[model samples]
Target: MSVADAVAPPRIRCLAVDDEPLALGMVCAFIEQTPFLELVGQHDSAVAALQAVHAQPAIELLFLDIKMPGLSGLELARVLQNGPRVIFTTAFNHYALEGYKVDALDYLLKPFGYEEFLRAALKARAYFALLAGGAAPAPVPPAAPEEDHIYLKVEYQLVRVTLADIVYVEGLKDYVKVHLASAARPLLVLTSLRRLGEKLPSRHFLRIHRSYIVGLGHVQAVARGTVQLRGQTLPVSEGYREAFDQFFNRWK
Candidate 1:
């Protein structure tokens, strides 16, 4: 393998186990996109994956699915001795936290987006590197002020906007539109308001409505349930108004 291939995060010599052929293809495609990963082989059955891993000790990673015909992914993982690092791919959210018992690097939910997959891959890379004499990755730095930001890749452009700059965010089904300061148009993203909410400073951003988050710093006006910011009127919903009130009162 070339130097580039040797060092790419995905090139860790992978074996993917999934009963669904389409799922297997999608995982393989993702692995192909990364320079560091290589598909040593794939298996539709957990038993087959187990046999291959035992036969081929050099396979360093397993992207095994949790729900499979015959032996379950967890059962297969348990039977193997001196097995490769595992990254469980599953649809069940309940199984996510439980995967750590078998020493899984990460647990990926089914129908995962590229970004979500990348996040899990990040965990796997750090775990492998640390095992190979690399120091443990540093704890995430505390988010302060403008530290909470998102990179919007749109139309071949990357726009960096802090959570503080947002006047409000409106969710449109699977997408969200962020109204920020000094932007002519809202920063549209293929994400949820809930996801963006996690990246924001809780003290500053309030989910006054199911689809809206008004930045505390940008609250231009408030009268009853109505919130006015940047000449835009937002609502403090019945369910969330108390949350806003508690936060707003504490800030005062």
Candidate 2:
């Protein structure tokens, strides 16, 4: 075999579950087109998927739907022990936060085309490749932030707040609540965690979870891969752990 062929891992065994027939078909089509993925089966319900996983323990990846009739995909994921790694495909963006809580590999917002599907699929492939080879991917290096203050819209008003005043940020669907050291209540604004992450000074802030971004200056402690703020404890996911660790090590 050629060097590339020799080094390439075997095709990842996968299954798909979605209540929507068209959406499920798209997932199946994506798997079929991807040379590195092998679609073992596709089901219309989480219940069927449970049986499939039980029968075929070799399923390494699952394209699951979050909203199903009986057993929701999230419910199935919660109950299944040692189930395949999940990549949730859903029409609702609100479930993005919940998906990470269950440690999903990735979340694909519905009406997502092949390109978006391929991106999520690629992440799963890399994750499985690392698991099979006993190698972890390098963590992304954190960048220095130069901005001191950020502005946000709250109740039809633009509020300017200093970066040092921020304790942390909490994401809820399309909106984020900015907790500050000076304010009694968090500032609520309609924006995504991803967008806020980019706007914030990366050096002083870290996205510790899918739903949380914490100011490094405000972090009192980190225990068990979780960041302890003044009153809240935020989880640091495996994907963001490396960067957070590197940042913490430098600060300490």
Candidate 3:
């Protein structure tokens, strides 16, 4: 075998789906140009893509478009809860929130350039690499002051969120829903709970469960195996129970 073949990185099998022929073609082209991505199939409908996914269980990634005729991209993602990761490509920016809700790896706006596409592809590569037990890349340095506030990618914009306003954070696979005191709906961002936990000030936020992090100041009551905030009760997993108890004792 050639040295190049032996040294080549493992390619992530990918499937592209878009109702528009041009859009579908562009996505497939991008996948082909990416060295770490292998284009396995291209389909113009979500149903066909679903079929492909079932037939080809080796597919690790999906470039999905949000708005399709019979089965929308969002619907497909929800149905494939344990399936391959998704990277949404769509013209409508409004679907960004929905995409995150379904735990998409990244969202590429319509008319995106190759640079944007490559950035999204790299994210997928890193994600799969981590899953394969590869060394993780260093976290990006926070742009804003880590103490006072931090910036979160909300939809297409980076919104500065004050540290104190956060009541809690709920982890959903590849996304986190930041529950704020000033907002009715939680702001969903594309990040893992462990990574976000590192960004938050440990003094104010304590992880109660693998899927939850609570702001100490917002917690009203601490009961056995649970904590209450804003009329909502959250579990305190066995792993974090000891640390939680220590924090609870400090206030008593």
Candidate 4:
């Protein structure tokens, strides 16, 4: 390798794939923060990721989630050969050994901080760096445990809705209506918005009003103390305005 080649930072073409929208958003955000990692695409499913991988041959790194509805990350890893090096991003701790069995570069537990994520990313960078330098790949470290999802009780049954699926929740006196993706109507549950908001991940959901709590991922537009969702606009109460503004400023 020449002097320029040794110093030149190789852009790691990356792709993020997770069934949870909020989770995928976080991974993409982390990738964008890394100077050497170039985000090529993001997908909500392993099937979609497979399609993207086939379409883009240059993608060299994958941040993949496990336990999706269909075509889990492990299955996708099995199907692809000579494909991008994968770093399994999952909520479950039990899958760590399974991930390494497939020769994954790393395992990223859910709700990982930037420091943890950056550590894994750098390992991938080092792996590629070694390959570029004509050396054997380095060993990847085991992942630490992190919180990931929440369960909600709706109607007469328990509903397991990932924090990512919740768009916005509306409180009507004693009941809170959860507006989630793929649901034709909101899931009305007997709970206060404040109570439900407390259960959700604070980084992803914000209580803008006494009656409404909006998921930051689903927020499309914000103007004049109001936030726009898919079809509804919710006001930001004076009590929460400052916090909402802070989140908006950082998000934008």
Find the candidate with the highest TM-score and give its number: 4
Q: What TM-score goes with each of the models? A: 0.51, 0.54, 0.53, 0.59
Model 4 vs. true fold: TM = 0.59
Ranking by lDDT: 3, 4, 2, 1
Q: Which residue pairs does candidate 2 place in steric collision?
A: none
lDDT of 2 by residue, 119-160 (tens): 787788768878787454344343352455789988799999
Number of colliding residue pairs in model 4: 0
* Local distance difference test, candidate 1: 0.74
Across 93-202, the per-residue lDDT of candidate 1 in tens digits comes to 57866688888888876545455556666567677777787564554443242344668755568788765567788988988898877687987887788997887767
Which segments of model 2 are wrong by more than 4 Å?
134-252
lDDT of 1 at 42: 88
> After superposing candidate 1, which stretches have Cα over 4 Å from the reference?
1-10, 135-252
Backbone clashes, each candidate: 5, 0, 0, 0
lDDT of 4 by residue, 1-252 (tens): 999678776789999998776567778888998988999999989999999999998999999998888899999988875789999998666899989889999897665567788889889988898888854335556557444556778778898777666789999989989998668898889888888887886866789988888877666677768998777899999989888888666444
Clashing pairs in 4: none
In candidate 3, how many clashes are counted? Answer: 0
Best-performing candidate as measured by lDDT: 3
Native-to-model Cα distance after best TM-score fit, residue 117 in candidate 2, in Å: 0.8
For model 4, what is the C-alpha lDDT against the true structure?
0.83
